[model samples]
Target chain A: MIDVLYFAWVRERIGLPRERIETGAATVAELVEELRGREERYQAAFADLTSLRVALDQELASFDAPLAGVREVAFFPPMTGG
Target chain B: MRIAVQAEPFDLGAEVSAFTAGVRGAGAVVSFTGLVRDEGGSLSGMEIEHYPGMTGKAISGIAAEAVARWNLVDALVIHRYGKLAPGEAIMMVATAALHRGDAFAAAEYLMDYLKSRAPFWKKELSAGGEAWVAAKDSDEDALKRW
Candidate 1:
C-alpha cells in the first residue's frame, strides 16, 4: 500500500487530501492511470498531467519514475511559493 | 545554513539580526523578504499551503546549493505557510559572502528556486472569494538565468 496525496485544486476536485491505496502499478504514471480509473473525481484531478507535479517519498519525481518500495506519492499543481 | 518552514509568523528584523549576528569572515550580507501584495486593493489576505514533509527538505536542498555555488559564509531561509494579511511577510532569504556580488547573486538564486521548486501553493483571498494563484510562466523563465 502507498499513500497518495493531492494538493491545492487537485484536492478540492478530489474531495480528499490523502488516501491509502493498494495497487500493483509499476510506475508513477501507471499509478496515476490506476487512480484515474477509480472514479470521476480522480479522473478530473488526473486529467492534465502537464499542469501537475508529482513527488515520490517526499522528493520531486517524474511520472515515469518507478514506484517500487515507495511509500508515498503526491500530486499537485505547479508551486507558487516565493 | 538554516531552513525553517512553519505556519507561525516571524519577525524580519529579528531574523536578519540573528542571521548576521555571529558572522566572522563575511563582508557582505543580502536579505530579501517576500510579502503578500494587495494589488488594486482587492486582496484581503493570502493562504499558503505546503507539503509539511517536503517543505523543509526542499528548502534545505536549495540553501545548500546556494551556499556551495557562491561560497557563502552562511545562509538562512524562513518561509511561513498559513493565513496572512496583506503586506504581511510570506518568506525571507539571507545570504552572507565575501563580496556583494556573490551575496546578491546567491539571494536571487535562492528566491528563484524557492518560487518554482518548493512545494507551496498560494491562494489569494479577495472580496470576490479565494483563488489559487497561478504559477506565472515568467517564474519558470526566471529559472533559466540560474
Candidate 2:
C-alpha cells in the first residue's frame, strides 16, 4: 500500500488530501492512468500532466520514475512558494 | 544553518538581529523578506498550503546548497504557511558571508530555489473568490542564472 497525497487545486478537485491505495503499477505514469480510470474527479485533476508535478517519497520525480519501494506519492500544481 | 517551517508569524527584525549576532566572523549579512502584496486592493488574504513531511527537508536541502556554493558562514530560512493577511510577512531568508557579494548572491539563490522548488502552494483570496497562484515562468527562468 502506498499513500497518495494531493495538494492545492488538485486536492480541491479530488476532495481529499491523501489516501491509501493498493496498486501494482510499475511507474508513476501508470499509477496516474489507473487513478484517471477510477473517477471523473481524478481525471479532471490529472487531465493535464504538464501542469502537475509529482514526488516520490517526498522527493521530486518524473512520471517515468519507478514505484519500486516508494511509500508516498504526491501530486500538485507547480509550486508558487517564496 | 537554521530552517523553520511554522504557522506562527515571525518578527523580521528580531530574526535578522538574532541571525546577525550568531555569525561570529562574517563581515556582511544579507536578508530578504517576502510580503503578501494585495495588488489593486483585490486581494484580501492568502492561504498557503504545503506538503507537511517535505517542507522542512526541501528547504534545508536548498539552504545546504547555498551554504556549500557560496561558502556562507551561516544561513537561516523561515517560512510560514496557512492563512496570511495582505502586507504581512510570508517568509524570509538570511545569509552571512565574508563579503557582501557572496551574501547577496547566496540570498538570491536561496530565493530563486525556494520560489520554484519548494512544495508550498499559495492561494489568493479576493472579493471575486479564491484561486491558486500559478507559478510564474519568470521564477523558473531565474533559476537558470545559478
Best by lDDT: 2
What would the DockQ be for model 2?
A: 0.95
Error of 1 at A72 (Å): 0.6
Per-residue lDDT value at B82 in model 2: 97
- Give the Å error, residue B125, model 2: 0.4
Clashes (N, CA, C under 3 Å) per candidate: 0, 0
* Each model's DockQ score: 0.92, 0.95
- lDDT of model 2, residue B93: 99
Model 2, range A2-79, lDDT digits (tens) per residue? Answer: 999999999999999999999999999999999999999999999999999999999999999999999999999999
- Please give the range of 10 consecutive residues that has the lowest summed lDDT in model 1 chain B: B15-24
lDDT of 1 by residue, A1-82 (tens): 9999989999999998999999999999999899899899989999999999999998999999999999999999999999
Candidate 1 A-chain TM-score: 0.97
- List per-prediction Cα lDDT, in the order shown: 0.94, 0.97
In candidate 2, the second chain superimposes onto the true chain B with a TM-score of 0.99
